[model samples]
Target: MKLLQIDSSITAPNSVSRVITAAVVERLRQTHPGLQVIERDIIGAALDHITPVNFPSSHPISALAGDAPEFAAGRATSDAILDEFLAADIVVIGAPMYNFGVPSQLKAWIDRVIVPGKTFSYGPEGVKGLIPGKRVIIAISRGNLYGSDQPTAALEHVETYLRSVFSFVGITNLQFIVAEGVQLGPDARQAALDKALQETSVLKAA
Candidate 1:
């Protein structure tokens, strides 16, 4: 299986989300000895925001390609990102909630992957999902405790937003390992990390 691991956290060795993400990959490698892993670090690469990925390069009807050089360049980057997403069997992402939402770098990566015809298409019935078989696992870290059970759960947008994007593309198999309340105290942070690491280690074999 080809696994794509995306890490967005700027903080490296000390990041809880990165720690969990590594553990998840380790678990997958343990289960499947031949797993091929591809790592994309969003912040590290300094990915740009998306513009136009819907336009085809070889359209027979128009000279749009010659008219827009910017679109051509933008499409190249988008295509590379989309290609990776399409090729992966399992996707592992490090998502750190910043101000109740996903980091801008991660959002930028998400934008580049959502092509109109490639990932999804609008039809008479509804929006159709083109890619539906990949499994997505997210390692999410939050400064405050905000999950389905926390007081500020409603304000949490990182996981919810990612779910919507992946679901829209028909990839609904999602799992999350969360380390919450990291900023509360050192003990709370360590405890959350421990729990998330445990969860990552016990990830189901399939």
Candidate 2:
């Protein structure tokens, strides 16, 4: 089995999402012996944001017109990113909320993977996802409380956006292990981390 681990936390060693993702991966590894793990740190990679030149719609035109050097490089990076996601049986993402949304680096990675005709398609009835049966586990960290009962729940975009995106691409076997209110205080942070770690410990093997 292949597992693709994507970490986008800029905080690295101190990142709560990173910690949770690592624990989740470790737990999975313990259960699934010989699992091949592929790691991608978007912060370290510095993936470029999507642009007109690198967009899929322009790829054919660029090829016909002789792709610019920069465009060619960008296309290759995007293709490789997409290929990695496609090849993985399980995907684990470390997503730390930035301003209540996903990190820009993670968003850039999402842009590369949500390619039409590759991950999804439009049918006569409506839009349909092409990639199904892949397991996706997201480790989310937020400084503020954003549970459904919390006053700030309306502002929680990290999990909401990811759930929509993955579902759009036909991934139904998705799960999230969240650590929220980390900035409330040291005690709160520890409590949240402990809770999330416990959740990871019980995660079903990929």
Candidate 3:
């Protein structure tokens, strides 16, 4: 078994989502001692935006070689990310929801990994998923609780976006463990974390 862990938390040493992600990895490692684990800390090296200097680089038909300028270098980064996604049997991502969506770092990583023809293709049949049959788990942490019908719950674009993107790539098996209301209070925070851990166990069992 192979597992890819992606952590996007800007908080160091005290990220709730990171803790849960680690626990999930530990549990999986215990179950599958021979599993290969690959960890990518997105905060450490974020993706570059589609700037004027790098816009052409992202295109697959760009004229620049892989050894071209550094700032606009896209083929190597895109290939690395794509290879990691392709090699993983399971992908675990620690996503911290910021401002009702995912962090910029996570979004950038998504942009880098989600190549048009590589992950998906739009043909006469409409859209098709190229990378199928992979398990994905997103460990999400948020300062506010959302998802239910209530005034306190805000709209969540992060989870929805991730689901869409992953599904577009042909990964139908997806799970999310959320640690919500962390900034509400200690009790709320603990309760949310506990719920997330419990969900993790359920996922593992499944």
In angstroms, how far off is 74's CA in candidate 1? 3.7
Instruction: Tell how far residue 166 is off in model 2, in angstroms.
Output: 0.3
Residues 1-206, candidate 3: write the lDDT tens digits: 89999999999687999998998898788767798999999888777764334433444644343435674456566657778987898899999888888888888778766766777888998999988878898899988878677575658877888999899899988888888889899999999999988877655622
Tell me model 3's lDDT, rounded to 2 decimals: 0.80
How many pairs of residues in model 1 come into backbone collision?
0
lDDT of each: 0.84, 0.90, 0.80
Please identify model 2 stretches exceeding 4 Å from their true place: 56-66
Candidate 3 C-alpha error for residue 86, in Å: 1.2
Model 1 lDDT on a 0 to 1 scale: 0.84
Model 2 C-alpha lDDT per residue in residues 1-206, reported as the tens digit of each score: 99999999999789999999999999999989999999999999888788766655323433554567767777777788888999999999999999989999999999888877889888898989989989999999999999999988999999999999999999999999999999999999999999999999998875
**Candidate 2, TM-score vs. the true structure?**
0.94
Instruction: Report lDDT (Cα) of residue 56, candidate 2.
Output: 50
Candidate 1 positional error at 10, Å: 1.5
**Candidate 3 Cα deviation (angstroms), residue 106:** 0.5
Pick the TM-score winner: 2
The true-structure Cα RMSD of candidate 3 reads 2.7
Q: Against the hidden reference, what TM-scores do the models get?
A: 0.90, 0.94, 0.88
- Candidate 1: residue pairs that collide: none
In candidate 2, list every pair of residues with a backbone clash: none
